[model samples]
Target: MRGKAVVVTGGTRGVGAGIAAAFVRAGAEVVVCARRPPEKPVEGAVFAPLDLRDPQAVRGFFEALARVDVLVNNAGGTPYRLLAQSEAERHARVLELNLTAPLTATLAAYDRLRRARGSVVMIGSVSGTRPSPGAAAYGAAKAGLENLARSMAVEWAPDIRVNTLVLGMVRTELSALHYGGEDGVEAVSRTVPAGRLADPVEVGEAAVFLASDAAAYISGASLLVHGGGERPAYLDAATVNKEE
Candidate 1:
């Protein structure tokens, strides 16, 4: 990845930061953008302030770029709010951040990406494929994101390759908050077939693969970095005795 330039949205921390670090390690000139700077700067990554929701700013950001080898749309998240707990506008906001923001960013970077024959990596979630009760809006947006990537891949073929990374639960700094506590995190981790939460660096490595020439022929693909996914709940609910 030497001499390659990569942009990672919301790359200040967490999964995004990991992705940026991985690219830096791979010798790419990585630039990380977010609305605010990270508390601790990501080593080897240049920081650029960007509000992905603002179309004008997104356009200018991309227009000023000399070249972009990869665009990783990794900025997106939602609070644990039930449908009834929030208004439609609140849900719409979530969708805008996760779905619309990527579209806006992509369109703005279209020319540069096309010129460089770049790749796009959409950070998706397993929630999109299953029932996400608390984060229904987020899941819906992610599902839409994957579909959008497929269409974009086809529309911009041979110039830009678009793909989705369907990720499972990751062990981020904020994991304890979502899983309750250490014990809760452990309990939830046990539910996954891998017996543990995925590391952010692992997701970063996968993103690197999708962006590198290693995946030259790959496009419009949904790569699962779910660590074997969750074990079927039905298996634990079975009433029949195993031993006769």
Candidate 2:
């Protein structure tokens, strides 16, 4: 990744921050953008201020960008709530952020990517593959996102590679808000087959691989970065009837 120019959207914090930091450590010139600024400067990354939800702003951002060799679309999250209780507007908002924003950004950056023969790594979620109970809309949006990546891969073939890193639970600074506390974190972690949440750095490493020459042959792939994913409930249900 040395000497490469990388752009990471929603790179102010959480998984996005980790991805940008990793690229910087690999000697890439990283440009990170978010609606708000990070609490502190990331050592080797330059910050770009923009809201990706606005199509015009997004288009302008990419047009004004220097040179990019990698683009990591990592800005997305769900506001956990049951679908029935949420308003249609709220659901649409989530979809716009999770799906539309990335699409707009990708299209805006297409030419530069083609010129550089660069890669685009989208930060997807495992919820898209399974039934997301509390966050139904988010799941639907992510499913669309994965499909969009596949289409983009074909449309931009031989010039750019597009892939997704479908993630599970990750331990970030925001973990406390989502998992409650240490005990809550442990309780949630236990549900995963790996018995732990993923480290953000590990996710960064995966992104690096997908963006590097090593994964040059890989395109339109949805790589599961979950900690073995959640265990099926039926396994334990069946165990209940077993003899001692």
Candidate 3:
């Protein structure tokens, strides 16, 4: 990765920061972007404030870049909002952030990526693969994102590579908001086959591998970074013997 210029959206903290750090370790010149600066610094990386939702700003951000070898579309999230709890506009906002924003960024960076034969790593969620009762919009957007990546891979083939990192419950600074306090987190962890939430660094490492030459020829693929995924609910409620 030496001499490669990498861009990580929403890399100020959490999974984004972890990805940035990994790239830095791999000797890439990493630029981390977000709406605001990181509260804590990611050593060996530069910070660039960006609002991915704004098309004009996104274009300008990419246009100003001299070179781009890789793009990590890691900026996106949603609060817990049941389908009926929020207005359509609210749900639209979630879609804009999770789906539209990445598309905007990719379009803006297309020229540079094509020039460099670069790769794109999309940060996706398990919510997209299953029912998301509380975050329906986010789930829909992520599912769309993976589909979009597949299409992009087909359309932009032989020039750029695009893939998604399908992630599950990850322990970050904001974990408690989704899983509650420590006990809540523990209970949730027990439900996963891996018996624990993933660390941001783990997600980062996977992203790095997908972007690296090791994964060459891999495109339009969804890599699950989840810890063996969630356990089936029916298994625990079955009438079978405890020892099987």
lDDT order of candidates, best first? 1, 3, 2
Per-residue lDDT, model 1, residue 203, is 92
Q: What lDDT does candidate 3 reach at residue 234?
A: 91
Model 2 CA deviation exceeding 4 Å by range: 240-243
lDDT of 3: 0.94
Q: Compared with the true structure, what per-residue lDDT tens digits does model 3 show for residues 31-139? A: 9999999999899999998999999999999999999999999999998898887799999999999999999999999999999999999999999999999899999
Report each candidate's C-alpha RMSD, comma-separated, in the order given. Answer: 1.0, 1.3, 1.0
Model 3 segments more than 4 A misplaced: none
Worst 10 residues of 2 by lDDT: 232-241
Report the lDDT tens digits of candidate 1 across residue range 91-181.
Answer: 9999999999999999988998999999999999999999999999999999999999999999999999999999999998899999999
TM-score of 1: 0.98
The residue-level lDDT of candidate 1 at 115 comes to: 92
Candidate 2: pairs in clash = none
Q: Which ten residues in a row have the lowest lDDT in candidate 1?
A: 235-244
The models' CA-based lDDT, in order, is 0.95, 0.92, 0.94
